[model samples]
Target: MKLIFEKSVPGRCCALLPACDVPVRPLESRFARKDPPRLPELSEVDLSRHYTALAGRVHGVNDGFYPLGSCTMKYNPALHEELAALPGFAGVHPLQPQHTVQGCLEVLARAEALLCEVTGMEQMTFQPAAGAHGELTGLLLIKAYHRDRGDAARTKIIVPDSAHGTNPASASMAGFEVVNIPSAPDGCVDLEALRAAVGPDTAGLMLTNPNTLGLFDRNILQITRIVHEAGGLNYYDGANLNAVMGVARPGDMGFDVVHLNLHKTFSTPHGGGGPGSGAVGAGALLAPFLPAPRAAAAGGGYAFETPPKSIGTVKAFYGNFLVVVRALAYILTLGGDGLSEASENAVLNANYLKALLAPYAPPACAGVCMHEFVVTLERLKKETGVTALDVAKAMLDCGIHPPTMYFPLIVHEALMFEPTETESKETLDWAAAQITGILRRAAEDPQSLHAAPCTTPVGRPDEVAAARAPKLRYRFDTL
Candidate 1:
């Protein structure tokens, strides 16, 4: 469990250099650094074992149940990775000529078309690098569309209290004043509140259908209609689209803009700070304002085209190419029916797991949940001093990654769980059992739950102190 640098041996070095194939050029004086960086020195075997041990400590979908709630931690197919690793997709340089990268362009074009068909959008741009990035891109599109028509007065965006934290942040980042609305008694948008909130300055309403509460709003159409009727637009947050995928279309629901999390609904998840794609899709209303150089069908082959009044480049180039490659392969492999089935299974898994845990910890809302559910330990905390954080820490000892803790900010002591379609019934059963055991421990020995997770290499950390005074590196006095 030592740090990589701690294991460094001064005399050791990895055998990496090959004999000079040609002439070796020395660096000029101005271009060279006076002292070399202090990097770990180790033999090949030493480096291999260090990383292998680190890998073993990590938890992922392949390791065990990963019901991460709003973040759908579904299992990706091996085939998607294989396809992305192909030479034509992986080897092509971003600056390659149009004719030379036909196959790559085709991947973009085909994915755009299929995704548009799924979301009921007219066009898409793989420019945004992540979901929040896509949210900004989509917001810019809405802002441009309104400004183009001399409707500069529309400078506000409405967001529900149950929305992802990024929704209001994205709106604010896009220079729109965010108007917050409260959720109704049933965890859906409060219609009356939304009705009163829209006005001359209303740019749009940013919402996630089957929202962060894990409930589909039956009033979605009416909600979107209200924004359109008010001379504003509706922006769909596709972070939770896995709950409805082929079951419904956001465009048909009257939304004009949507930012899809390719990592969430699509197979190429960018967990742990991975490279990701958050392709934005728009209806005809905002299509012309989309980011530039999207794959377009050009005569016999494909070509890149910028929209008439494009918002310009969002990223340096077309989004994480390998991520897009993996996503396209996932969609093609699943097809229409398979995608629909995947959504259905996702819903089923969530509901099934919710039922098992309902006896121990009541859910935040009543009735059916879509692809995820939130359970509150408020009552347990009040009765036994065992908060959601204690229960989550207890889960680590059970060898399970705990559900999202204290999220959505609506419910007190909230723990959200999303057992995606990829999980089996047995896995769900075991996770429920582990959680139930934790609940029993909370009731029987409240003090013990406070010091839970006794088995991990590292125990609970002082997160607030760590954030404020972070120990950023190893203490090497004389490197």
Candidate 2:
């Protein structure tokens, strides 16, 4: 494809402006430019066609099956986009008087209510911008709660070894020392190790139920009880909440604080550092420390009200109101029953793939998984010297996005797959078949696996050079 600038005509214009009506200052006195700005000069038709072609080259959930594990790239309803784009919802200003934007506040309030109902929490604060940001905010709330109760010495947070990296990073950012507890052979938190880790200095334990390996911690109730007995809180990282949405509630599990990724669980468009909403919910104990200004009933309408001791503003305004609107639409579309069915289907699809791939590459543990599953390529690596990276590259040639590789940091040759609820049974079967074929091919012809993605617009580059000497901006000279 030609660069847009390369198609530029010297004097072409997309629009014609009328003569300036206001008195204008002399150019020498008012402006400091020696030459006019250089911009693309293409016809409207030319510009439209160029962008349309570019959009077609991109891959998304709408394009095909996206089985990127731990990322839950599920299909979003088109109604969400249509509803979020409505002028009344999208055109409102954050600083508008509360009375003027009652409808917007009502939408936010309803979102909070729905989140509270879904997660089984007392209150929610839609202040964090993303999942990590929500983690930070939730940790800060924990810090404040401890300090207020005169437990300043409780400054240690325990995280499992298989947890997402953000858990420890967020804990560290909140001024707590992070202690990693290893998972047992069964892929769940080691109860004995956890008991040893918890003490007077422990403030909380951050955990995901169906951990990154997609194995549910069956002892979650006992784990929460142990933490509480030690005078510590349990923080639920809702990254994998899609696995247990309607089946379980964090609050019922004795979690004091939780953060839900609206994009992942509620079907919102999220990628490339987002346009995401991560609403933090709190049990009654932590409710008083939620971020301000929380939505409250005022007269006959909703309005913002700050708690007595909040964590202050995590975002400039109500965080990502449009994203919240989209989430609300999704919730309304998928009532409680539909959401449960989605979770069940997600688990069913994952287990189906697990069964198909077990003979080829089984997980570290046994039994059924939750919403996603991980398979290792250790045998293929030992026999053919072809690694999981080679298999991932080979997937692109088969016209499918690769599953997440080398993740969870638990398995050696991990290929994490999450066929979300949106995928069909045929799609799941085809994906498993392709993966099996790739492994078989790798055994026969290892070199083909190493040199893969032969059918992309551009082949792979030298990864080291691409990272260290990145060409972020276009250069006319290079063209």
Candidate 3:
């Protein structure tokens, strides 16, 4: 396929506009650029075709199965999208008067209430824009709460080795020193290691229940108790909340602060970088320190309030508002019972896929998993010199988006798969068969796997080069 710029033809345009009706204002010399900007010139038909081709190249949940683990690449219902796109919700600006945007405010308030019920948190702020941002916001709340109590020496955040990388990054961003705790052989947090890590300097623990390895920690309550006993707050990274949505609540697990990935767990369109709603929820202790201008109940209506001891505004206006609308739509559409069923189906799909693929790529942990699970290609790699990357690339040839590769850091040649609730048994079976076939091919002819993904428009990107020196946009010289 040629770049759109390569297909550009001189003096070609879609439509000729009428003469300007308004008087034109000349720009000051200081405000004007020395050279006219260069852009691709193409006829309407050519431009449309070019973009249509590019769109086809972009694979999304709508395109096919996406089992990217820990990301919850599930199929969000289009109904939520339709509801979010309604003019009253989508057209309103944040700067609109409070009374005028009452409907928007009410929607936000209702969404917060539903999320609170699901997570068992007292108060929530839809400020932080993504899960990591939520993590940072939650940590800041912990920091403020501890400092307010004069426990200023508490500056360390304990994170398990099996946690999302964002866990430590968010902690560090919040100016807290991160203490790394190892995972036990069973892939849950090592309780003894956690115990050893906490002390006077410990501020909190940022944990992802049903962590990156996708195993729910049986010791979650005891884990939170240890932190609370040490005067450290517990922060729950609700990335894996899909596995336990209505099944359990983070607050019940004793977490002081929780951050939910509304985009992932809730039915919001995320990925390709966001427009995600992190939406931090807090237990009573951390509520006072939540980000400012939170939606609150006022008489029979909803109003925004900055908590007396707020950490100030974390975002301009509220969060990604439309994302909130979509999430809220999902909650209302599913209701309580449907939400629980979604969780159950998500867990069931994951376990079923894990069982099917066990022979080709054994899981990183024993026993059943929750919504997602990790499988390592250690044996396949040793026997066939086909690393996890090769298997992933081969999946592309099979018209399947690959599982997350080399993640959770702990698993060797990891391929984390999360066949979320939206996937059917037929889809799971096809994915399993594809993996099994790929592994067989890997063993029989490793070289072909190494050169896999011949089916895609571009094969075998120079990943290291692309990362270090990316050609992000088109340049005339590149042609």
Index of the highest-TM-score prediction: 1
User: Can you write out model 1's per-residue Cα lDDT over 1-479, one digit (the tens) per residue?
Assistant: 88899999888997788989999898798999988888989999998999899988888777888788888889977787888889988899988999999998999999999999999999999989999999999999999999999998999999998888899999999999999999985569999999999998999999999888899999999999999999999999998999998999999999998988888899785557667788999999999999988899999999998899999998897988788888988998899998999999999999999999999999999999999999999999999999999999999888888899998788999999998999999998988998998898888999889998799878888899989988788879945
How do all the candidates rank in terms of TM-score, highest first? 1, 3, 2
* Model 3 spans with C-alpha error above 4 angstroms: 9-22, 468-470
Please give the TM-score that candidate 1 achieves against the real structure: 0.97
lDDT of 2 by residue, 1-479 (tens): 88788889888877867878999766684567777777889889988999898887777788788888988889988899999999998888989988999999898899888889889999998889989999999999999999999998899999999999999999999999999999886568899999999999999999998888898888999999999999999999999999987899999988999999999998998855598888899999999999999988788999899988898988898898889999999888888998899899999999998998888786756888999998888877998999999999998888788999998788889999999999999998998899889988988999998999798777776889988989886786776
* Regions of candidate 2 where Cα sits further than 4 Å from its true position: 1-13, 16-43, 271-273, 475-479
Q: Could you tell me every candidate's TM-score relative to the true structure?
A: 0.97, 0.94, 0.96
Predicted candidate 3 versus true structure: per-residue lDDT over 84-161, tens digit per residue: 889998888888888888889988899999999999999999999999999999999999999999888998999988
Candidate number that wins on TM-score, 1 or 3: 1
**lDDT of each prediction vs. the true structure?**
0.91, 0.89, 0.91
Residue-pair clashes per prediction, in order, are 1, 0, 0
Query: Which residue runs does candidate 1 get wrong by more than 4 Å?
Result: 19-22
Instruction: Single out the weakest 10-residue window by summed lDDT for candidate 2.
Output: 24-33
